[model samples]
Target chain A: MTVRSGAAARSGARGRPGAGGRPGGVARLVVRTVSEVCVTAGTLIVLFVVYVLFWTGVRADSAMDGEIGKLQDQWSTGPVAAGTPGATGGQPSGPGKQPPYENGKSFAVMYIPRFGADWSKPVLEGTAVDVLKKGLGHYGRTARLGETGNFAVAGHRRTYGDPFKDFPRLRPGDAVVLTDGTTWFTYRIDRRPYRTLPTDIGVIDPVPRESGYSGPGRYLTLTTCEPEWGHSHRLIAWAHLDSTQPVERGRPSALTG
Target chain B: MYGWIWRHLPGNAWVKALVSLVLVLAIVYVLFQYVFPWAEPLLPFNDVTVDRGMGAVR
Candidate 1:
């Protein structure tokens, strides 16, 4: 009986308490739970970063392609007249006289040779986030293409194909070409990218107060986020109207160069 | 805690693993679809503009 009782006592000690009642068991449980939570949170943060940086670019590229196709179809159906002032070999046209574009409507395609030979993105009216996601967005209050005053545009530098990813590489006299299905408007980069505040609306002024120009003239302003990944500040590049050419005249010297 | 969970859990090791996976997925889905979306605007991710000496720009 004594041997049997000792065996039973040992079994009891091993069976239940050893499984759940060990000293510091609660502390171990707490530490394990906290660590698991941290690991889960860390994984989630990584996934979110991937979604923002990589997935957005994929979605934006496809959307931009669709917008370009639609613009091409529209232009093909209603080709602009040849030999107009806005066309090749024609004289410079007057200001604010070109066709009016509706809000969110795509009116032209912008090319920055510094970006790449095949780099072109649709220019759509409005600076709304949704609009910029599709492609480069034109400031609604700014001047029209090839017109007097500041024709300002904005785009993302990090996501949505990062249209302005190489904006900083643009040097003075670099070409920023735009086409409205009829004529090509070439603007020469007059200033390298300058850092500015987002509220500095003066950068998009008729004369662009920040551009150091006091008088009204045909100016182009390109704005994007600084640091490539963050939007805490804006990087702006200023340009002036240099020339105009028709599609029939073929690509401009700026494009060829 | 894990030992307690193991003891309470029914069936074999595979059953426990599958249940744990499903539970983890449910928690992640809830956090992503509801908690994170609700908390995003409160974060600073949308503050695209800096406050220059002049004032807030954006």
Candidate 2:
């Protein structure tokens, strides 16, 4: 009888508690389930908020791009108005010149369709302040757009919500469309990662590491802060210009007049 | 009356704590995910347009 009683007590302890049965156990379960639901809901809410904030930043950036796009369009098609002067050339430098940037800070804006409309930013002339503020900047001596040389463009990777948000996704053979849209230039990704300092002026040199030039095959280099804000290295995406297409105003394919 | 009182009370301390956490989380989730979006546009800078051209030097 004693042994039977001990077994019965042990059975009750194991059955109701260990086996997940009992009114109190049900109550505990209800609490746990509700807690889990709350945590999951909270996590989702935070994620959604983050997504919304990113969307807002994207919109603001797009608005800025729109204004710059207008100016680029005018400069691309509109006449250089016959021999415009330097920084003093009230007339547009007409393409290869230091893009008509304000304050000695000329910039070329590169827009990639696959990267989204807002991916556009001022290409600063040599990673300077004035240029970074406006957009991605072109290396001063790198091959000018349309020229058969290495055209290097650099931008911030993390700050300002990471302008190159989708850059890491670019694959070889991906089409990178750069336009003032009048002079549409396409570059195919070719090179792998190359690390260099802000002052490594030679990295953007026209001659690309002895890659025998096919008569200055138009090349492109994209530089951004590496590993995010830490900037311990520079991420470079290199490509060769595949083709160019001209946009006629009021045309169906042109982004604008 | 006694049974009703017991029903209203949580089964244990852990259950009470869990219920409290759940309630708090639900309130936070509703406020941020649903309510905040509706309220964001009302903020002054929320829609304030930034004129980038303003920084362009003549």
**Root-mean-square deviation of every model:** 7.0, 12.1
Provide per-model DockQ scores: 0.17, 0.05
Runs off by more than 4 Å, candidate 1 = A1-23, A79-100, B1-58
The segments of candidate 2 whose C-alpha lies over 4 angstroms from its true place after superposition are A1-63, A66-108, A122-126, A196-199, A210-215, A249-257, B1-58
Candidate 1 chain A weakest ten by summed lDDT: A81-90
Q: Highest TM-score: which candidate? A: 1
Candidate 2 lDDT, tens digit per residue, B1-58? 2233336768686786677678668966786557755654443222111111222321
The CAPRI-style docking tier of model 2 reads: incorrect
A1-257 per-residue lDDT for model 1 (tens digits): 99999999999767766676765677777899998789867988886666566766787789888888898898788765444443544345675556556888787899888899999999998776567778888877778777667788888777667788888898998999998888888999987788987677788778876686778777899988776766567888999888887776888898886
True contacts kept of each: 0.15, 0.00
Complex DockQ, candidate 2:
0.05
